[model samples]
Target: MRSEALQNWLNQFTSRSEILKNIRDLEKNNEELFEELLREGLTYEEVKSRYTDFSYYKGLKIPEGARALRAVEVYVGIMDFSDPSVMRLPGWHDGNTPSANLIDTSALFGALSKRIERPFLANKTIYSRSNCLIRYTGEALYQLDWDVLHALICFCRGQFNKRFEVRQIDILKMIGLSKAGYNYDLLKDSIVRLRKTDIYIESSSKSPAMSFSIGEVKSLPKGKRRRIDTFSLILEATILDNNVLALTLDARLKFLFGNNEYGLIDWEKRNKLKNNDIAKKIQCLISGQKTNMQRHRMEKLYQLMGLTSSFKEFTRLLKHACEVLLAAGVIKAYAIPAAPRGAGQDRIITIWTTEIPTPEELQAVGRVAAYACGE
Candidate 1:
C-alpha cells in the first residue's frame, strides 16, 4: 500500500504523447499533491491551469498525439535505491569518440585517460582487474545508454522481484526524460538495445565471465481509441489503463541484488545531470555515504565507469566531470592525489560535501550543459 501523498503523485494524472495530460482530474482529489507540485517549481497558476481544464483525452492513441490514461496506479519505484553496484567494463574507448564496433572482443584493459581520438589498444590476453565486461548485440551505445542499463538493474534489485513488467513511459521518467521531450523512436530502440545487451560477470579470479541481458519487452496496444480529447470530457476513473506494455528482467542477475551493494541515490542531482557520463556515474557511485564523502583509486574508478579514453583524455574528462559537479554543487570539494607516473604508489580521487545542495543552490550555479547531438 502507498501513502495517500505518494499515490496522488503516481495516480493523479493522464498523459498524451508521454507528456502529462490529466492532472486536473487528480487535483480535485488531492489538494496536497497539487500543492507539492507547486513546490516542485510549478507555479500555482500553472498547476491550476493544467488540471482545471483537462477535458481532453477521450479516444487518444499514444502514437497519434492523443492523451491516454497512464494506468500506472501502483508505483513501485521505491525499490529504486536498493542496489547501486554496477559491473566493471573493460574501460577503454576511442577517446570520447564512441565506437560502433557492435561487438567489442578487444578489452581496453586498464588503458588510461582518453585525450586524443585513436584506436584503443586493449589488453586482450592479460587478466583485467575487473569482475566482468559488456558486449552489445547491436547498435552503437551512448553514455546515456549505459545509464539506462544501470537504472534497470537498480529497479530489479530494489523491488525484490527478479522479473520486471514495466511501461515504457515509466521507464523514461525514471531515467530522467520527460515523456514528451524524448524521441519516441529512439526510446523504443533503446529498449531493444538494452534487451540485446549482455553483461559478463566473473564468479571468481579463475572463473570465466558469465553473460546476461537486461530483460524482455513487449508492447500491448489497447482496443480501438476512445477518442477522449476532442470530446472534451473525461471521468477521472478512465486514466487507469495507461500502461500499454510491460518489460521483465532476467532472474540470473538477482544474485547481484541486496543491501550494502546498492547506494541510496540523490535523484534530484541525477535528474539535473546533463551530458556527463562520468559525472552521472560519480553521482551513483558515491551515494548515501556515512560522512557525505567517498574515495576511490583512479584505476578502480576507471574500471567501474568502463572508461576507454586515453589516460590524458580520460583525466581531462574526469576533471570536466568534477568541475561540472562542483559547479552544480553536487560536491563541495574534490581532489586527486597527483602521484608521479611509475611512482609505484596508487593515485586516488576524493569528493566530499557537508550537505547535498538544494535545488536553489543548483539553479544559482547554473546547470551543466546538455550534450548537443551531431552538431
Candidate 2:
C-alpha cells in the first residue's frame, strides 16, 4: 500500500474499540522478542546498535537532545510587570526577547511562594535551590500553560534518565572502582531499581518495561563455562519529549517489536477514556488542597477549547494539532528506532505544549486536537 494510504488505514483502525483490545494483548507477548534475542546470544551493544543508536557514529542521525527539542517549539512573550501605581517595574523588556539573565528557579519559587501565600522553606538540593539564571520574574508567570508544563516535565524526565545512568557510571569510574567486580554490580542493580520505579508498572500482565532482562553474560549463557565476561540490555521504555509522537511509537513498539502478540483493550466495548478528560482527572488527582484552585483553570481550558465531547476523539485531534504545529515550525518530531509493539485501535501519544500560550493560541491548539480526533 502507498504510505499515505497505509497511514490512513492505521489511523482508522486505531480509532476503533475492538482494535485497542487486540493491541494490548499484542504488547504483552512482544516482550519475548528481546528474550529470544538474548537466548540466541545477542549482546546489548548489538541490539542497541540495531535499534536505539546510543553510540556515536559518523553520518548517523542520533536523536536530538531533549532540551533542544523543547527550545524549538517553545513560545516566548513579554510580561507586563507594572506596579500598583502603573509604573513599569525594573527588568521589564519591550518585546518577545527573553532577558539574558533568566530568573532562576529559586526566584521563581519565591514568586510562587508569594503568590500562593506560603512560607519559603529552603533546601540545599539543586531541585530545591533552582537555577540561578535571571530573566524577568514577571514574564515567567505567563509560561505556566499545561503544554509548556508538559514539555518541561518531558525535559526533566530525559535529563533525569541520562544523568542517572551516565553520571553514576562516571562517578564509579572516577573512584577507581574495579570494572569487573563491585562497581559493575552496583550500577546494574541501580539501573534495575530505577527502571522499576520510573518505567515499569506493577500489574498482573507484567508491564513490558520489566518484561525484558539485562543480557548479563551469566544469564545469557546458562550452563556454559564462558565465565560471564560481558552483557548489555536495552531498556524498552524510552520516551522522548514529543508526547504525542512518543506515545504513538511506544504503543506500536510495545505491540509489534517484541515476541508478545497480545493486543490493546477494545475502545468501543471497553469504553476508552478521553484525553482531555483524563488530563483533567489526572490534574485533579495530582492536585492537593493547595492546588485545588488550579483545577478551575483547566476546566476553563476545556471550555475555551471546546473539547467537551468524547476523550478518544480529543486524542486524535491532538495528534492532528501536533502535525499542524510541526508543519508550522512550532514543534519538531522524532522518529523512534523501532515500530511500536501493540495491536488495535488506540493511538498512544506523549505530546508537550508550550509553557505559555495566549488564550487565543491555547484555543487554537485545542481546536486542532478536536479536529484530528474527528470530534
Candidate 3:
C-alpha cells in the first residue's frame, strides 16, 4: 500500500515538472527570436560597439520636427534656462557675482510656466549650474514634440551650456513631481533602459553659432602654446565640426586616386615621417607642439633636402588631418594668413585650400597674419 502511494505522488510531480520545462523552453525561444529581429541587418560587433560611445538622444527615433512628449519636456528645460530672470543677473556671467534677491525654483517656474498668462514658468532653484528640472508629467506624455526639444537643446547649449543627461530620481522631488508618492523609479528605469538599447543618446557640447578650426591656436618659436586670443570658444566649435566633416569627405575622395588611370599608385608607400630628429620635430608641429629653432635654419632645412616638397604633401595631409580632428571634436576651424613682406602685398592664404577665400573666411584672417608672416 505504501509503495503504491509513493508511486502515485511521483507520477503527479513528473507531469508538473514537464510543464515547467516546456514553459522555460518557450521563454528561451521568444528571447532568441526577439534578438534575431533586433539584429536583422547589423553585425554582432557593429551593434556591440555603438554603446561604447556616449551621446545625448532625446527619444526613440525623434525625427526632425516630429512632435513627442519627451521632446517637449526637453524644450521646457531650455526655456527655463533662457528666462530673463536667469539671464539678467548682474554677476551671472561671472558665476561669483552675487544677487541681493535670488529667485527660488517654484516661484521662477510659476512665473515662467504659464502657457498663455505666463509661458516661461520654471520649478527648481535657478542658481548656478543647478538645473531647472521639468518633471516628466504623464498628462502631456503623447504630445511631447521633439523638434521643439531639439531647438531648445541647441539653443540652451549654444546660449547657456545647458545639457541633458540621464534623468535623476532626486530630480522628481526637486521639481515637485513626487506628491502622489508615485514610483517615478519606474519612469527613470524606462529611460535608463532606452539609453542602453538606443544608438542616438550620444551628444556633443553644442556647436557654436559660427564655425572655426584647429588652426586658431598655434605653437610659438620657443616650444610654447600660444592662445588664439581673438577666436571665441563658440566660433571654435563651429569650425571644428566643419573641419571634421570636410576631412571625412577628403579621405573618401582620396580613394579616387587609386585608379591606375590616375597614376596615384604608391611604389614605396613613402614613409615621409622617418625616425630622423627633424622629422620628429615636424611631427610635433603637426601634433600641436612647439619647439625652439632658428627660423633661418628651419627654412634652410626646408630647402636642403627638399622637405618643402614633402611639406607640400604634408600640408595636404594636414588639411585632411585637421578635418579628421575636427570630426573627432579635437579642434576648430581657423583661417591662417600667408607670410607678409615689407612694401609687399599682404594676401590672404586659405590654409586648407588653394582658392582665394570668401569674405566670411577673411573675417578672422588678421589674427593669424603675423604668425603666418613668420615675424
Scored by lDDT, the top model is 1
Q: Give the 10-residue window scoring lowest on summed lDDT in candidate 2.
A: 75-84
Error of 3 at 123 (Å): 69
lDDT of 1 by residue, 1-375 (tens): 123464445544343312244455544576554333332211122222333234355764243111112111111111221232222112222111111111111232122224533232221222233443332223334445554554554444333223455565765766677777454455665556555433343322220111222223233468753221111000011112454334445433332321112334444566566667677666655653456545666666665555555566666677778777777666775665555667312556666655554455444434232211110
- Candidate 1 local Cα displacement, residue 304, angstroms: 3.7
lDDT, ranked from best to worst: 1, 2, 3
TM-score of each candidate structure, all chains considered together: 0.45, 0.17, 0.15
lDDT of 1: 0.41
Clashes of each: 31, 67, 29
lDDT of 3 by residue, 1-375 (tens): 012332342245344345333433333454432222222111122322232222235654533222222222222223221121122221122111111111111111111111233122122112211322121111111101111121222223223222233233333322223434344543333233222221101111121101112112335778764423221111111112221210001111111111110111111111222113232222222222121211212232232222224444433433443344333322233243444454112333233211234456556455542222111
Worst 10 residues of 1 by lDDT: 229-238
lDDT score of residue 318 within candidate 3 = 36
lDDT of each: 0.41, 0.25, 0.24
| Cα-based RMSD of candidate 3 | 28.2
Choose 2 or 3, whichever is better by lDDT: 2
- Per-residue lDDT, model 3, residue 364, is 48
- Of the two candidates 1 and 3, the one with more favorable TM-score, higher being better, is 1
Q: How many backbone clashes are present in model 1? A: 31
